[model samples]
Target: MQMMMAGARTRTTTTMMTTTTTTMMMLRRVWIPVLILMMFGITGGEERTWNTEPAYETQGVNVTVIEGKSAILPCSVHDPTSADNKPVKVVWTDQWSTILTFQDNTIIDDERIHVDHAFAREWNLRINRVKYGDQGIYTCQVNTEPVISYTVHLTVVVAPRLSNDGTGGMLEVMEGSKAELVCNATGIPAPTITWFRKTADMGERRESEFCTGTSIVRRYSSFSQRIGEAGQVLVIHNVTRFCGGIYECVAENGVPPSVRREIQVKVKFMPKISLPSKRISTQKFY
Candidate 1:
């Protein structure tokens, strides 16, 4: 009886040890795989979230700027190229030579031109004090295996200029004789000239004498061919004392302000001789 009882206790002890070892092995199998899967999920999420790739985009076709001012040439990209996540290199050139260079997100030694980038996408160039020499085709190139580029045409507009030989002022004409006043102005757009007279109240008085008015008949003669532009002309067929005043020649070409000049006309006639009345030299001298 004592031997049998001892054998039963030994079997129970062995069974308990075997059960504990099996539970430990099963726990390791479940938790170890779970930890590994969690680590992989986290790593994959990071990789997908932080994807830095190069993309290409177009900004514009052309840009216009005024002379003595600034100009901005725009460029863009869908993805920025990089070697080791470094900023993509950018270069700006014209038909002649290179104007700027942007490498590692910084400008090079060029001072007249620079980059104006924002939102990590915009790649625009700023040209300070634009000149006529700056007008041309500009290209923006990216340093890529198969280099991507965009071309933009730049136009520089110069302000309108005007010049004249300083004529048409204070014209003196004899009565019954023809009078002609000429106005000449030079500009980029070939300025248009109009003639008018000044009134006593500082108002414009324009009529048959205008440069663009119809022909006026005077004493059976037509002055049609007399009034035209070859430098603009204002002709008076039969000059008289009433036909003299201050004439203004206004020249304009869509510039900010128009240019004008004033001319005075004086009609001369034969002087009439008048006899002085000798009214009794009042008082003495008799």
Candidate 2:
């Protein structure tokens, strides 16, 4: 009986030892996996949030202008080829002018301005004879996922410019009778003509600059004639005393403000007069 009891006790002790060893083995496996997971987490570092501000490829453009001269508002752009998933929308605006809109190729025209060509994605705006009032902040808005904008400030400088052809008369005219004033100009974009005359009050008056004579100053005949392949001729016919004055011929090339040329007209006649009135006074008395 004593031996059987001692055998039972021994088996119970062995069973308890086995159970403890199994629990310790299971804990060792769990610890290895937990340590690996913690190490990976430590090396991974923290995640960063996305930036909310809009991305810009470049800064604004710079524009220069001459007062009393025409200019083109220029804006530089970069093609975002990668982010081309969305179409680009460009909007240009000036403080004193209405909003100008542009897309891939088409341009919109309004009463204030006109687009020379739209389809080529040329967003250049032509400002006729830049005045001080025309200078302002021009903004270029490009739309994609986030909107990108560029601002260009136009600086206008006051400078003398030729606004018209110096010639008031046609290319040819009668010799002794009368010759009209004639003038012409060449420039970029194009220019307008305003005749000026020396007045008693002001050295030059824009309104009365054309005529102070008996000869009729007909309507200004304007026609555009093609010169060479790249040249052009502008003609105005039937010039007279009224057509004579400080003629302002302005030429603008879209970049540099308008340029001008000043011309003086002087009519010459024969030394001899054929009329009988001068000799008749001597002969008629008889």
Candidate 3:
């Protein structure tokens, strides 16, 4: 009876140890999946936060200016909260290189270019004495996580100018011959050339007045009639004495200050003489 009791106690002890080991294995199987799921949830949340994009408002613009004038390129940040407690950095660039930069309350040094930070949200660039060479594309960039930028196009306009070579000079044509007059001009928007002819009466009066060097000129004395032609060249078909006078060429565009050039045209013909006695008879060796 004593041996049987001891054997029963040893079996009970082994059964208890086996039950504890089985419970530990089951707990590990359940907790391992739960821990992996928790880790995955934490990593996904972090990725979504990092992938979010900042919200800011900006727009591209077109700027126009006349030559020898000032130009302004505008840029503004509508929502400063997008920076998220970080200082904002701004940079201006052209096709060639960087023009200006603003960071930490400091701006890069440049001649004829500066930031007009009159307002807290404004970062406008001002250019003094703009020239034809300054016309092109300019970019305004902000250093954000993904970077944001705005583009501006600059257009420079110039007034019409007449060329000097063979533009205004005296032109003589024979009777019943064709005559051609040319006027050359250049400008930013391209120039439109118009031809005008002074009337015979006006031409004669202007000539007389000019010869006398008179200051006071008669009204309508310099008036001219349009030739109903537009181009760099004006052609006269079968020219005659009526076509002889002063011609004016006017070049104009949208820009200010139109230009003009004057040309003088003279017509020549054969002279005729009549004799009283069938060609005057001359005495030979009288």
Q: Which residue pairs in candidate 3 collide?
A: none
Q: TM per model? A: 0.52, 0.31, 0.63
Task: Name model 1 segments beyond 4 Å from true.
Answer: 1-56, 103-111, 167-286
| Model 2 TM-score (2 dp) | 0.31
Runs in model 3 lying further than 4 Å from the true structure: 1-58, 80-86, 103-110, 200-222, 272-286
| Candidates in descending TM-score order | 3, 1, 2
Top TM-score model: 3
Taking the tens digit of each residue's C-alpha lDDT, what string does model 2 give over 1-286? 9999999999999999999999998886666444533432322446322233224444566677666666666544455322423334455666643355444322334444544434333456566767777677877665433345677788775543443443443234333344444334433334444333323333333333343422222223522111111112322334443343333233445545545444444433336657655543455653
Best by the lDDT measure: 3
Q: How much is the lDDT of residue 207 in candidate 2?
A: 32
**CA lDDT scores, all candidates in order:** 0.64, 0.47, 0.70
Error of 2 at 20 (Å): 97
lDDT of 1 by residue, 1-286 (tens): 9999999999999999999999998887666545533432332343322244456577558787767789988888766746467566566667774435443232335466777877576678788898878889888876554456788899876554444546546788898889888776754355778666554431222433432333332322212112343356777777766567666677776644567777888879888799998876557664
